[model samples]
Target: MSTPVVLIHGMWCTGGDWKRVRDLLEPRGYRCHAPTLPAHEPTADQPLRVGDRSLREYRDFLEQYIREQDFRTPPILVGHSMGALLAQQLAARIPVFAAVLLTPAAPWGINAAGLANLAPFARVLGRWGFWNRPYKFSREAAAAYVYNGLSPERQKACYERMVHESGRVAYEIGLWWADWGKTTSVDADAVRCPVYVVSCGADRLTPAFAVRRVAGLYPQATHRHYPDRGHWVIDDEETEEMIHGICGWLRPLEQRAARGQQAPR
Candidate 1:
């Protein structure tokens, strides 16, 4: 029996963003699922009050989705950016086969300082109603912040597919305000499953140093560093290589399970 894999996308993106990785994983016997987060569907008929939504709400939504599925074996959770934060929270709440985080945002207590990293959003972050409104990045800004490792042509193509992200969520991540009774904190002691963290050196939004700090929290985690890759590693030129790396990591875990070995919690 193959382990179920759920791919969670970051802010300003939808489940479709995981298409490239899903396409590769599915053919290799992994049951891949990339569900869009609530209020994040790009073509929704009505506007969502995402400003009122919190990190707990997003975590709850994912928990419910996985519970409803009731898989035979614990599913592997893979997430990027904000989704990665949710994945970590979910792993602590439920039993999972494993978890993979790509350029994930720093969790509660992790300091992500540096003016240059947040300079692009300076204009909107100060607005009183910022959380109540949708936020989208211009092509040029997106290219610099997210696709710095890609060529000009590829950056433009990726920019075309970008969507608006929830300002409230962004604010929470930026200020580390998601710590509601430790709900948003990644409790390393509680997360017994294997964790794989892949950090991109060129990720301005969530820089390598911050991500490395996150990986350090999980003593049992396997950390991979890509000094030249950008934040959007899953969609960049090294997409295939990243996919292969994930597959390589999962192969041994799957084999252990197949041999009736208990996965360390």
Candidate 2:
């Protein structure tokens, strides 16, 4: 049987963000699932419904979604940015085959703050009550940072798919220490699955420095970097190369499972 892979996207994005990834992985016999997070539905020009919703909501929705699938084997969890942090938390709470965190946002207690990382959020953070409302990055901010690796046309196309995110969730991630809920906390030691954490060299929001620290949380994590790609990875023409690289890493694990041998912890 094919291995199941659940692809989780981050803030300001829905399951649709994994189109490139799904298109590639499904043909290769992996069952890929990309579920939109709660409150990230397209509300176009309307007051955002993500009002004051916490990250815990997203985590609960995904955990339930994964359980309902009932795969013969635990699915591999692949997450990007904030979703990466969610994947890490889920790995600790559930049975997972493995996890691939792409340009992951730092989990609770890790400070990825530097000029490079914080610059992208400078304007977004300027707004009063930003911590209590829904927010989306301005096109200018996104083009300059999130989708910086893409051409103008590609960037424009990707930008069209952007969605509003919960300000409460953002605040939780940015100031995790102050969060009484500890929503972003991950018990790295509880995640026994093999982990692959990738970082984009030019990514301003979640830079390599923070990604490296996230990787260190897992004892068996393999760290890789794409010097050319940033957060808008799937939108870039070279996305196939990166997806193929990730598939290459997953294939051996799939093979071992097929033979009834568990991959190393």
Which candidate has the top score in lDDT? 2
Clash pairs (backbone) in predicted model 1: 192-265
Q: What lDDT score is found at residue 226 in candidate 2?
A: 86
Instruction: State the lDDT of candidate 1 residue by residue for 1-265, as single tens digits.
Output: 6669989888777889898898888888999888888877766532354545667788898999999889999999999988888999899889899999999988888887687688878876878877666777778889889878889998888787777777777677776654455545777778888999999877898888999998998887999999988888778788888889888988988888889997654
Candidate 2 wrong stretches, greater than 4 Å: 45-47
Cα deviation at 60, candidate 2, in Å, is 0.4
* Candidate 2 local Cα displacement, residue 131, angstroms: 1.9
- Lowest lDDT 10-residue stretch of candidate 2: 43-52
Candidate lDDT values, in order: 0.83, 0.86
TM-score of each: 0.93, 0.95
TM-score, cand. 2 vs. native: 0.95
lDDT, candidate 2, 166-251, per-residue tens: 88888899878888888899988999999999898888888888899999998899888988778776557777887888889888
